[model samples]
Structure formats: structure tokens, C-alpha cells
Target: MRLTQHDATAPTGMRNNYVVMRPQNLSVGVLPVHDDGSVTLVGQQRFGLMNYSWEMPEGGAPYDEDPIDGVKRELAEEAGLAASHWREALKIELSNSITDQRAMAWVAWGLSAMPIAPDPTEIIRVTRVPFGDLMREIARGSVRDMFTVATTLRAYHMAHQGELPPCLAKAMLASVR
Candidate 1:
């Protein structure tokens, strides 16, 4: 929640000064798949970068809130989609050395169109791409968001491991060649 700089003497009698950041946030990333096997992605215009970045639907949740709930809300708000099936795909410490921020990634399917209600401050573009195409873009460095990259790779692993439904996995991986 705050950053502070402090100076201290080490056991070797050496002086050290460093800045410490305290973070109190948890986030969720959702990779939504359509029944037809395409995956939903969102393009967000980041103010800091003054450029648009493509990534899975993601948002910050209060530390006390359920990650699944937060991601479900994000999917609807950012992609205008709702999913009936959900699976926890990964949990990661995002930039742990510098911040306490943690993220939960989810794979969701059985999707249907929904009303989008994005935050007024956000400008998002939603698109659907075939699973293999999405993977290719990621491999080419087009989709560079850490959360999206992690979640997509995890989903690909799940498909190969037969963790996903057979039909869906087949549809998703069909274009890999």
C-alpha cells in the first residue's frame, strides 16, 4: 500500500539504503473459450504506455473477494461474455521481488453473449481468435501481457493432458498444425 526508503547497518558494518513497496492487491485473469473453440481477447489502451495491448480479460479483486468471482465479472465486463464452466489454471506471484501482487488464472468455456459493463475509465476492444492463431500470436510476441501468456500456455497444457473435455480440446488444438 505504500513505498518507503530506509537506511540500516548490516552485520558486516556496511550501510545499505533501499526502497520497499507494500502492495495489498490480488488480481484474476480469465481465458474464455467459445463453444466453437475460439478464444476471447481484449485490447486495452494503457495510459502509461500510450498504446494498446492485447490480453485476456483481467481485473483486480479485493484481497477478501473470491478470485473466480472477480474473473467472472471481468470476463463479462471486458469481453461481453459469460461462461458456465470454469477451471483454475494457474496461480502466480506477479513481480514478487518488487510487489506483493498475486494473480489467479482461469480457463472458462460454455460461453454466451452478455452485456458489457466496463469501467468508464477503460477503453477495451474485444475480439475472438482461433486457439491456434492466438497461440501463434503469443509465440510471435504479439500478446505480451504476462497474465495472458501464462494462462494461454497453461490452457494448452491442459488440452494436451486431457484435462479438458475431449471435444473442446480437439477443436482447440485442431489448427495447431
Candidate 2:
């Protein structure tokens, strides 16, 4: 395989300037969609926060495993539900304070309608929240799970052009706080 080299000193255009070593780990994610137009999310106590907030379950992609497969595994491991139908959505560079990683977004539907076996390290509750509540959460800036809110809203926009379920839109309009 052919690879390009670039400079490390320049702030950008590193593709033609340098080659950096990759980290030892990777991550992938998915937003499980519900038939009723809601989404299955999770809540966990976060840093700089008093309590938990809503977010779709997600986690790492295993070595050599397909991103899609990784997302399915994450769903089962994080939410305890097996994912079936899915589609590729977006791929983004997840840059955080400590590391740079690739996180993929997927659209998964047709849940198994059964219980999940979440990871022991995770203290999360799988919640079925209507879009209205999520929109309100966004409006109030109460959604600490920025990824969850952004990805799901984009997917919802993709599915319905920002016209989420009618009740949700009505609620969003009413909750102008």
C-alpha cells in the first residue's frame, strides 16, 4: 500500500508534510432509532456535572472489526440490546483533551425487544425519549451529551427534514425557554 508523508511542524496539510503514529485504540458509535420516531438513549453522571443526562449508548471498535460490527457490539455491551438493521451515517474525528480518535456514526433500527446486558464499568440506564424532550433538553442546554444530541438531531433531520414528530415540534415551540 502507498502512504503519503508530510511535515510535522506545519499546523495543517500534514498529509503532504508528515506521518504520525496512530494510537492503540479506536472508537465507534450508533444512535438506535425507535419505530415511534423516538430514540433509545442512556444517562450517566459526567464530569463537571451534578447528575446524569440523556445520550445514546456507544463505545470502542475492536481491532480489525468492521465499524458497523463494532457499533452493534457496543449496542449490546452498552445497552444490552442486539442491533439488526443499520446504515452508515457519518464519520467524524473525535478530538478531545487527551486524544484524537475516529468515531463513526450509524443509524440502527429494529431493536430485539429484549433486555440488555450493559458493561459492568458503565452505570447507565437505557431510556426511550421522545424527540420533544430531547429538543427541550437541547434548548435548555441541559443535554450534556453533546454528541448524542447533535448526531440524533442530524439523523432526525435526515429522516424528516427537521420536522420531528408533530408532538415534539409542538412541545419544542411551547418550551421556548
Cα deviation of 6, candidate 2, in Å: 13
lDDT of each: 0.88, 0.65
TM-score for all predictions?
0.91, 0.70
lDDT of 2 by residue, 81-110 (tens): 765677666677665533456677776777
lDDT, candidate 2, equals 0.65
Ten-residue region with minimum lDDT total, candidate 1: 18-27
lDDT tens digits by residue: candidate 1, 16-110: 88676766667898999877778999998977677789999998887888778888899999999999999899999888756667889999999
**Regions more than 4 Å wrong, model 1:** 4-16
Global Cα RMSD, each model: 2.2, 6.0
Model 1, position 144, has a per-residue lDDT of: 85
lDDT of 2 at 38: 63
